[model samples]
Target: MYLDMPIDRATPHVVRESVDAVRRWEPRCEVVRVIPSITESRETIRVQWRLADGVIRETEVPR
Candidate 1:
């Protein structure tokens, strides 16, 4: 369960929570870095992860 955070603190908070969820669900993947961006009309989260096989990949939410 998640609660809505204020805009000013939302980005980082959301990113942290999301990363934690991923780690809990996928133990074989390592979360490298999380980038959160907000524009006038959009909010995006870019997550970079390293898999157990050593392949790195990135994904953006709400693309």
Candidate 2:
């Protein structure tokens, strides 16, 4: 799966938490990759996650 999220100070932790939470709910689900983006003029973080199930999930963190 793929996940997109806004950039923020807690983005990393939130991503980790989300992955963990998902795993806790679905242990068979695997994480393929994680991508992070930070815009130059925005106080936001974008997080993207690719999953084994050929799905994408996105989250946004605002500062």
Best by lDDT: 1
Candidate 1: tens digits of C-alpha lDDT, residues 12-35: 788888799889998888999898
Give lDDT: candidate 1, residue 42. 62
Query: How do the residues 1-63 of candidate 2 rate in per-residue lDDT, one tens digit apiece?
Result: 223443464557655766677578866556544445556644443445456666866655654
Q: Any residue pairs clashing in model 1, and if so which?
A: none
Instruction: Kindly report the root-mean-square deviation of model 1 from the true structure over all alpha carbons.
Output: 2.4
lDDT of each: 0.79, 0.56
Off by over 4 Å in 2: 1-7, 36-63
Instruction: TM-score for candidate 1, please give it.
Output: 0.79
Model 1: lowest-lDDT 10 consecutive positions: 1-10
Model 1 clash tally, residue pairs: 0
